[model samples]
Target: MPDRIFLIHGYVEDPTIFDKLVPLLPPADYVPVNLADEFLRWQPINSVDARQVAQYLTNQYKITAEDTVIGHSMGGWIGIHIKQLTGAAVVQISTWTDQEKIKFPTHNLSVLRFFLKTGLTQSRFLTSFFLKQYPFDESTELYAHLLDNANKMSRLYIWQQLQTLFAKVSPLTVQPDLRIHARADNIVAPPDETFVEVPGDHFSLVFHAELVAEPIRTIIGNRPITDIW
Candidate 1:
């Protein structure tokens, strides 16, 4: 049995966001897990979520070290934890380390806090307006989707979990994870990623298939599967 490729999306994002990249690779097995549920319920802050996700898939589908996992933003954080549990090869995209928070701007952090406290659903315009001000260069399509389906409180809970996790990460534990970020990204900052440099902002960074697939292909030690379309 071939190892599987588990793709995790960021906060307020759905699995379809990975549609493009999923087809570009070989057919091992692909699972799209929704991190947020109806009412936008975010999972409790625990590294165990990652472990559980890995184990759940492994039981349902055979997974091993040869298998690859890719995650974006908060999803990347989950992927890291999953790696700890599974020792599977990982792909970290537009992600941050526990230590990387030190580099984020204070004002942005303030915006994050405000966004979380107010819950974005009630103030969609205001939330989108604030994110536009940031340095993100990705397509707003996904954000627009999130705005419609997301529960602000759920988003806040996940954000808080991420912040807490980042604060406590030890420096020695920061391993050589393959991180790919957009050069113009403002969400997590391109510099925070270890293997940086790709096109588009945080949202588009994942939405645009071509921009992300090449680097991901390299990291997974697989040759690029040329697009048929």
Candidate 2:
């Protein structure tokens, strides 16, 4: 059978995050799981749980041992939990197993969380100013998309994710088959031997799909597949 590749997106992001990587990968049944509908719809933060999302995806997709799950950021965390249930191979990009490994801009999440509670975080001025001051994105066009996304973003959901994300001692229970991180990633603490450090920030998969896609393609290509292309 053809290799199954499942693409899981992160918080508040749709399946379109993997658009650039899709065509670069080997032909297969590419399933981009949608886990952000609720977040995008402005649901309560308390309602969103990574484990719950993982469980839903596991049941919804009936992911098997032969399947490969590639996830970005928070999606990687969800994928790890799914792997624990489905025995599927997981690839984590820009995700940290250890809570201490996540390096937030300010160690005091309370300050950030407090700001997230207000409408200020979603304000056009604040969002645009942030993009200009702390530029993590690579594309000029993406800058505009991000500003647009901020308007639709739910600060409550992000606060919830941050609270739960750091509360865990070790979120990565299941070991992934491959780990890739960005060298200039300001969000996560420096990666060790477990990850192949690419040149980009937290969203390397978006701006630098070529850099990230090669290894993913190679892994899929080298794997034994019964399907004849």
Candidate 3:
């Protein structure tokens, strides 16, 4: 068997987001880590942050230098810390570096925490009415499951993650070996330079896995994928 390749999904997304991309990957034991399931279970000192979460994962999974971590969006941000712990190579997709500034809709984290902690973010009735009222495009479609996942997705999970992500704490200084991003992503717009430009947007991993997989294949090299779970 070749080295393990852990696939980390982004916020509010399950391992299913990788369904399309997994088949095209190079030979390795492709393992998808449910950031929600694992990260939510970890109790942290101070507040939850990427490094702490990564350490939890390192201890639980016995991550080592031979492994590779492939993370999408926010998952990619967390993957850097995994690299810090295990010396594992990292592949970041649709993610940003520390220098990149993001403009969140709500600057008030307290109010944002209120909704996520109260399960208001998973409200189907409110979501349905809002979709009807605003009619956001495909990106909104991407988050449609939020309406159905109220019971499955915990308020604590979302709230705690937001706290970790939004905390002024700087993400670890580790840089990924490869940074692949879609040029047309609406949700997390790709920077003009640096990234190996690919076709489509944030959802391209679903619609254009072939294109996304091209770069990944080269990085994965000659590893023979014996099995995946």
Candidate 4:
């Protein structure tokens, strides 16, 4: 049997975001989870929640160590926390690094405010309207997928997660980290303090599978995973 991997989605996203990448991945089983549901279940986000989620998903699939974790954006942060919690090798894409707030103050504040307000609303139209911020060009298949997911994601759950996120003392911190970022990214900039350069911005970085797959495969092959915490 192939090893197992847990692919966690970023804020305001669902598991389908990894559809393209998941298939291209090596033979390992991939379990994707909705971030909103996770946040809903775990009131205060921390390493413990991440560990529980990882263990639950792995158990559901009957997977063991030798699996890796792949996450993007907020998911990337979750990946690190999972690593700390589970002692898994992690491949973080377009990850928000510790230097982010200091490097891009305005962008960070804007995103925070948007998350704060968006997370509190439960409207489908409002949620759809908000996800339009992702850099999906009109003609791509990815655009259609985003549109479909806009309707599927739970607005109330997203809002609640954001509310909890707002109450967080510090969203990003340094510890057992592996991260990737686009050098030209404006959403999370300066690309330093535990981030590697990828091809595009946040959305593109997540969808770009080839760039991500190798790193993930390498990590999985290198070490055994564990439910550390």
Best by lDDT: 3
Global lDDT scores for all candidate models = 0.59, 0.70, 0.72, 0.55
Using TM-score as the yardstick, the better of models 2 and 3 is: 3
Q: Give the TM-score of candidate 1.
A: 0.68
Which scores better on TM-score, 3 or 4?
3
lDDT of 2 by residue, 1-229 (tens): 5567888876456688889877877778888876555344444435444566666677777777788899987778778877887888888888855656776565456686677777765777887776676555465466567557656866655665565464443345578777888877766765565677788787788878888888887777766644514
Give the better candidate number (1 or 4) by lDDT. 1
By summed lDDT, the worst window of 10 consecutive residues in model 4 runs over 99-108
lDDT of 3 by residue, 1-229 (tens): 3578999887678789889998888555778898777854665546676677778888888888788888887788778888987888898888765524343556356888777667666676666865565434645676566445544666777766676456555546567888888766655667554778877666677777898898888877743334432
The TM-scores, one per candidate, come to 0.68, 0.79, 0.82, 0.63
Clashing pairs in 2: none
Which regions of candidate 4 are displaced past 4 Å? Answer: 1-3, 36-67, 99-155, 164-166, 169-177, 205-207, 224-229
Question: Can you write out model 4's per-residue Cα lDDT over 42-102, one digit (the tens) per residue?
Answer: 5544433333544554544454335567776666655665555455566777654443332
> RMSD to native for every prediction?
5.5, 3.5, 3.5, 6.2
- Could you say which candidate leads in TM-score? 3
As a whole number from 0 to 100, the lDDT of residue 218 in candidate 1 is 63
- Please provide, for model 1 over 114-211, each residue's C-alpha lDDT reduced to its tens digit, 9 standing for 90 to 100: 75667643476856775566543356656666655554445555554445334343333434347777766666666543575776777654566776
Candidate 2's C-alpha lDDT? 0.70
lDDT winner between candidates 2 and 3: 3
